[model samples]
Target: MNKDFHYFGTYSAAILAGHSHEDALRIARSAFFVDLCTQPVLNSVGAPIEAATTMLAMEMADARSDIISQQDVTRTWASFHFLPYDLYSERKGCGKKYMQKYRLICKPNGDLLVDTVTQVKGKSLEATGLAMHVLADTWAHQNFAGTPSRVINDTNYHFFEILPDGSERRISLRPNPASPDDLIKGLFTGTMRQGKETSVMNLGHGRAGHLPDYSCMRYRYLPAWADYEEVIKDNPSDFMHAYCQMIYAMKYLKGEGGTFEKATYDTETVAPYKEKIEAIFEKRQTDDSEDWKAFGESLSGQEIPDFDTPDYLEEYHKAPEDKKDDTPMGRFILAALAQKSMVTNRVYKSGNILLGISGDYKDWGTKGIRAYLKLAKEVRKGGVI
Candidate 1:
């Protein structure tokens, strides 16, 4: 959900849940890192390519449509950005191929979300961040699949923004990649509809654009998967759910709470700031990063630093080989690999091979053997998957 929620909002949630400033920043940094930890960054840092959590624009352009490339895309995007609610959703009168993509549609309070959050219990701060990032996106990315599929991820619905005074403003959009989303005038930008069933335009929420990322937006449209039924996206409510759930998750991770269950939120912790937090969400703006940052700083009395990609990443690159795993980026890398492996395994076990089959990363014969071994360590120690 961009830096607003991924970085600043996450830090605020962590602090509200009783984490120290340092710990909150570490968790928020790892959560935001899911978007920036691309293959190019991995290459510069000499990190294992398999630990790559996100793909850069160039990487997306270079990716071929082969099964191997598809597997890589599904693994990263599905596990990290769009955690599926169910893999065995009923899809009658559809071919087996269509059902695979349909079943990957994301929804909030999914079983997978519970498993992911619980998987990071007693794990590193980096692991908590990764899980939080995934948790928050479940609200923002609902109804979109992680993989590329025109029928599955395409958004051709008529868009409207729900105004504060109970009015509906029909929003205009241009399918121009170069133009930014004009949030002030309520104009948006999205990917052009593609004819190819597997075109990249249909990946995740591209066709829907940044509307999902903005916290202030509440809109209505006919979802492709809803069979002409209208669906209202109440961002204030959904984003609030995400924030509260994150607090509950962090408390659980820190051993201050009970079991991590679906549909549960830590409302008591956020009760004091409910009005202020809701105000920020209801403020119509393209970028709410500044607002969230200000809120977090006010709560902590400590300045929330801007997101710097090289902070922890370069430290991992410069550290001695034997001591790298102790570094922030190294720890994050291990967590990423393990999380990816676990999610991939779950998808396969649930009878869906759309993300490809999962296997033991601990296989010593693998090309990136060190990454695999460390992945095994995180899995075994954390009891994740």
Candidate 2:
């Protein structure tokens, strides 16, 4: 989902879950930063540099150093939860089936999400926020896969546009077999990216772009090779469902419940928060704004300190070494790496790939945990990883 769910909606859920306003804001910020923490840059002397601020600066930077592995941890966490199409399905010659497993709303794979969240509940608020990101996407990205597949996502050359009044009219989509550059262009121009026959970095939502993540968007498509079409209506139920799940998960995390019992969508449990949620959406729409910082501040009922500024770093530098994990940045980094081993081994590579099983899966988790701890220690020393 968009920041509407990731930042604002998550904050609301934390509040509803009985967290203090300050704790709720931190959880929301961590949720949003999961997407923002992709870049890992190196300084002039080849020292790894952390993103001082959580704001987007152009496109995400590539992983370059051991220090950059922190970014990889976050990226990997995101891939498991959001870009989950990497796991192969059991069906033969049906890569699309693998992709469909993560589409929770209209598919049978939501149990995987619920189980994953249940295992990770009470680990930490940061971890819970990470799981929430994945849970929210199961609804917003119901039909799309995390991996790039031409047959599953590629649409025909036909074009359609949704007018201001919610009516659609035919418009020009970009030429067929759209290149990566063409796909980028189509994102800005509101034109569809026609799919290519071959697979070549045509990853998730490249054909549809970010429309699937927009809460206000409704789209329909007929795959060039498919017999039927898929229609996605603009609905808020997905957001409502996410909010309800967050509440339920929080209860389990708080030890109030032993297990997470999935609630029916739009049930009475979430009905009370519907008006508040609608008001948040209405204010966002009326303002036509995507300023997450301002929106988060409004939800937090306080002004947040800018972590990118030097003053924040000065305070960070002065904090006691043993108390580092209690600091905001330290807590975020620790939580990012905390569950890497479990997710990679148990969730991503649990004999789920296209190929058959190989070695002991527990070994994979062991190796991953070792690597994360080594790199995290290096980052704490001097950000040299």
Q: Note the Cα lDDT for every prediction shown.
A: 0.86, 0.49
Q: What TM-score would candidate 2 get against the native?
A: 0.67
**Shift in Å, residue 77, candidate 1:** 0.6
Predicted structure 1: clash tally: 0
- Badly placed stretches (over 4 Å) of model 2 are 41-109, 158-166, 171-201, 223-227, 263-269, 279-323, 338-340, 347-350, 354-370, 374-385
Q: Residue 215 in model 1: shift from native, Å?
A: 0.5
Q: Model 1, 292-329: lDDT tens per residue? A: 99999999999999878877777998999988888888
Taking all chains together, each candidate's TM-score versus the true structure is 0.95, 0.67
Return the TM-score for candidate 1, rounded to 2 decimals: 0.95
Find the 10 residues in a row with the least total lDDT in model 1: 360-369
Which one is best on TM-score? 1
Clashing pairs in 1: none
